[model samples]
Each structure stands twice: as structure tokens, then as C-alpha cells.
Target chain A: MSSIKPLVAVLCAGVLGLQGCASERSETALDQAAASFQAVKDDSNVLRSAPRDVIRAGESLARAERLSSYVGSGADVRHYAYLSQRYSEIAREHSNLVLNQERLAKLELERQRLQLALREAKLVSVQQQGKWLEAQIVSLATTQSDRGLVMTLGDVLFDTGQAELKNSASRTVLKLVQFLQLNPRRVVRIEGYTDSTGTPEDNLTLSRDRAQAVADMLVDLGVDEKRIQVEGYGDQYPIEANASERGRAQNRRVEIVFSDEKGHLGAPR
Target chain B: MALLALAGCATDPAPHEQMRLSEQALEQAKAVGATDEVAELKLAEDKLARARSNMASESYRDARLRAEQAELDARLAEARVLTLKSQEQLSLLQSRVNRLRKQLGEQQ
Candidate 1:
């Protein structure tokens, strides 16, 4: 009987020790849960964005606290504590999401406004550039009684016997595009002329191809194709005699004849 | 003895409703793109699996507690995923706004 009594006492002590350990663990969990709840409960942003979650966190913490007073309720206390901590975390995350969404909305509006402002600024700059280009074109042109305003593209703008305009022609072409854009009512006839070195048939085709190439470039640069006409005059009207290299070079030229601001292009020669 | 019996009766009802609720919460979290990569989601899945076994063994109280914790864990995982997505969007918008500001300054 004495031995049995000692065994029972030892067993009772072991049970008590286990209970003490469980309660200590539950106490730590409860403390952590309470701290988490406290942090979010007082935050106005959290409350505003996630009122339901904050309420749940508070309720869970209260349940954990109430269960902590009972013996053998350690597991229940810890379970509620875990729930309370999760609710607090969910509340904080929700608040952050809401705040971020608000910021995104404001930034989006600002971006749109800035985009509009930038577009307006670019248009104003283009208009200023158009005015400068118009002055340059006017100085480069000559007044002819029959052709109205005529500008000449020298033969150096293209390789010999090739209709393709060289890269150096981009500046002049861009200026012409700007001039046409500013004068929307005006039209131009692009005339291609070749020197007498090639056969008349070959010269005619080369002249047409050169004129068409220039027209294609103007259209690519945003000019309306309907505003321009192309013509090839094969060695028909030479400004210089085809005897010297310089004279032939002069003869192989493209001419742009502009209307008098009325959209009436001169007749093709 | 009657009070003890009542306490036991109260806890012995199988916790079928809590189990279903936990499962639903887990599914909802997964539907929101919460994978096992999320620590909370992994914990939720493991606990819910244990809760199911506890239910099979007639440990109703343990099953209920585990299911309840699992539901909250899954909910926290979903919330964290959404918060992370929002943070990414915030950074993207911030960079776009900064680019616009730089372009505007250059234009001036």
C-alpha cells in the first residue's frame, strides 16, 4: 500500500507538471495574440478599411483570455489566440491594400493629365517648327510665271541612274512635309526630268520612278497623296545643255511646283 | 457528475459544420492564387488534413479547434496574397508616374 501511494503521488505530480507546461505555452500565445490585436485595433486606417476583421480579432482575443482562466483549457486558449493573430494580420493587409488602391487611382489620374499636357506641348513645338520650315522652303524656291512657286531637288539627291532618294534628302523632304502640313489648302506637282545620256524611253521611266519615289516619301511622312501629283518629263525640258557633267547633273533634277495657296496644282508638262 | 456529462455531450457532436467551413475557406484561399508557397496556406492545409483524421477518430474537440485555426490561417494567406499584388501594382504605377514626370521636365 505504501508503494502504491507513492506511485499515485508521482503520477499526480507528473500530471500537474504537464498542465503547468501547457498553461505556460498558452500564456505566451495569448500574450502574442493580445499584442497583435492591440496594434490593429487602435489603427484608424485598419478600422476604416477592415472593420469586420478588426472586430473578429477582438472577439477571438477575448475568447482566448476567458479560456486562459480554466484548467486544461490551454489548447482552447491557444486556438483562439492563433485565430486572433490571424485576424489582426488580415486586417493590416486589407488596410494596406486599400491605401495602395487609393494611391494607384490618384497616380493614374495624374499620369493621364501629364500625358495630355505633353501632347499639347509637342503640338505647339511642331507648329513653331512648321513656321521655320516654311520660311526655308520659300527662300529655296523660285518664282516662275508659268509654274507659280518651284523648288528644285538637285541630282546629287539620288545615285546615278537610280531613282531612290539618298538619306541626305531626308532633311529637305521633312521640310517639304512640314510646309505642306502648314499649308493644307496648297497642292504640289512633283516633276521628274532626266539628262539625254540615257535612251528617251529609259529616261522617261527613270524620271517617273524618281518623281513617284519623292511622292511616296511625302505620303509616308504624313502628307495626303491626293494633294500631290507626279509626272515624268523624259529629257523634254533641260535647264542646262547635256554636254558637260555639271550640265547633265543639272538636267537630271526633280521639281516641286506649288499651287498659290488655293489647292489648284499647275498642269503637268 | 451531471455537469461533467453535459460538458462531454456538448463537445461530442462530430464538428461536421466546422470541418466543412474550414474546407470552404481553404478552397477560397486557393481560388485567390494562394499556393503552398505561402507559409500560412501550407499551415492551413496541414492542420485541416490533421483535423480530418481527428474527426475520423472521434476526437470532436480537437477536430473543431484544428478546423477553426485552419480557416483563419487560410484567410490570412489570401489577405497576404492580395496585399502583395496591391504592392506590386503600386510600384508599377509609381514607376510610370516617375517616367511621365521625367518626360515633362525634359520637355520644359
Candidate 2:
């Protein structure tokens, strides 16, 4: 086949040299070309379908038009037409693969964008709820020393020298739990601290007990068991100088810390 | 091959050509030893010798430091000689003033 092509090219060159470019090489093929494939040329299919077949068809048509000009110039010039057809087929195959890859890449990018958007939306919702709950923190630890939410105990939550929660304390804690439910993703650390006057060990024990009691209330309210961390500091870290009774009362309180992002505070039981 | 070629250029001077920069500094300082600067240079040189010996026994950091101190001493000896000449001129001027003061007192 390779040897035949050069021979045909030499013949055509010789013939064209004899006559001018306008002279017809043959009468039959000189008229016009009919569409090669009977398949309906669906334009939409070309744009929307795999680009391989359409591109191949296009290449075939171009080659045929070229060969139509050189019909009688050689015997079985159709071989060159076939080679050109192969080129179209190759183009079509590669183009289809590229299109499919592009489509898949776009879908994956869209999925990632949606996931990011969903995460941001959830974060916004949780932040809004935290801010709302912050408004509900009334009986907060009096002196604003550190950053975490400091809840004040309005005597309705506890009795003198008692680490147990009052019924009212339970009610307020339930409300807190509901607010926390809005952002259940974080773990809550419960700390109990007291005024500066008891046996160091006893105060430590009392603070611990009070913190645990609050944790218990939260647990019963369906908060995650693992998320509720309880610790007691006894009568140590006073918000104000423990020189006064008011300052001592101010120091006695419980604190809750939330440490997760998804608002799914529901640790396994 | 390259290292050998360069080694041929590496040569040490004769013993007398070996400059005792530290001792020379000491002598010039004695020539004008009234200046405290010369004493300070001698003290610094002594300290450097101590540092070098200590450094040679794997005390590399200390040895490098003592070598630096020795350089400072050599410079200090030269400064001391200059200071002594300046002081000598000042002393002669003071004596002239004292002699004039005695004349003034006797005539009065």
C-alpha cells in the first residue's frame, strides 16, 4: 500500500503538469458527491453525543471532496480516502473520551462545592443558636474573668452548703440542654467552684459534687454522657476577693463548655 | 593534583621572620608603660592563653574566642604608646605653670 501511494502521486503530478489546474481528470466523479453515510445527520446528536463519531464523519466528508478533484488521476485512489477516514475515526474516539472526562470532572467539582456550602450553612446555624443561648445565660458567674460562658446561680438552683440541684436549677438546666441541642456537636465540660471557706478537701469534694450533679441533669435530659465533663474546684477561684460575703456567693457556681463543631453533642449515651 | 600544586606555594618563613606580635606589643607598651592601657593588654593576653589551652582539648568554641582576645591585646598595646606621649606633653605644661605660680608668690 505504501509503494502504491507514491506511484499515484507521481501520476497525478504528471497529469496536472500536462494540463492546467482547471482541466477535469475524469467525467463521472467530476459531477458532485452524495452524502456517504445514509444515517440522518442529526445536528443535535453531533453537539450532545460523544464527539468521536461526528468528528470522524466530518473528516471523511473533507477527504472525499479532496479526492473528487483527483478521480481519473489514479487507479484505486480510494485507498487515500480510506486513510483519511481512519484519521476521522481516531479523532472522534479521542474527542469522546475527553468530553466524558470533562463532564465527570464538572460533576465532581459541583459535588465538592455543595458539600462546602452545606457545612457553612450548618456552622452558621450553630453559631446563631450559641448566641441565642448566650442570651439565656442569666445567673452567670458574676466577675467576667475568662472567656467561656459563666452561669450565675440565683439561689433557686442550690441551698447553703449544698451541692445538690434545686428543682428550679433542674428546670434552667433543661432549658440550657435544649439550647445546647441546637449545637449538639460540641462536648460540654461542667466545672463546680465554690466560695473560699471550707476544708480544702471538703470544698474540693463539694465543687466536684455540684459539677457532677449538673452533669447528671444534662445527661438525663439526653445530652451525651461523654460530652458532659464534670470537675469541682471547691472554694478556690473567687471571681472577686473572697473578703466579702457577696464575693463568696459570686464565686459559687457551675460552668458548661461546648467543644464540637457539628452541634452533634450526642456522644454515645 | 590541584591540592598538590597549591601545596607547592605554601611555605613557612624563617624563625627570625616569625613575628612575635604579642611580645612586640608588650615591649612598645613598656616603652610607655605608665599608661594603664598596656597593663590591660597584658591581662587580656594572659586570659587568651588560658582560653587557647582549654580550647585545644576539644574546647573549640573557647579556643576561637581566645584567639579573638589576643588580636584585641595587640591593638591595645599600640594605643597605650600613643596615650603615654600625650600624657608626657601635658605633664611638661603643668610644671611650667607651677614655676610661674612660685615667681608670682615671691614677687608679691
User: Considering just chain B, what TM-score does every model have?
Assistant: 0.89, 0.45
TM-score of chain B of 2: 0.45
For model 1, report DockQ.
0.32
lDDT of 2 by residue, B1-108 (tens): 223222332332222211244345545655655244456566656755665564445444334334434433544454444544544544554455455445444433
Q: Tell me each candidate's RMSD, in Å, in order.
A: 12.9, 39.3
Q: Tell me how candidate 1 scores on lDDT.
A: 0.87
DockQ of each: 0.32, 0.00
Question: Which residues of candidate 1, in runs, are more than 4 Å off?
Answer: A1-20, A127-269, B1-10
For candidate 2, write residues A8-110 as lDDT tens digits.
Answer: 5566566556553222332122222123222213434333543544454455545545544453422222332333333333333334444445545565565
> Whole-model lDDT, candidate 2?
0.53
The digit string of per-residue lDDT tens for model 1 on B4-81 reads 323753556798999998999899999989999999999999999999999888888778889988988998898888
Cα-based RMSD of candidate 1? 12.9
Residues A69-181, candidate 1: write the lDDT tens digits.
65556677888899998999999999998998898899889989989988877666755666787789989888899879999999999999999999999999988988998
10 residues in a row with least lDDT, candidate 1 chain A = A4-13
CA lDDT scores, all candidates in order = 0.87, 0.53
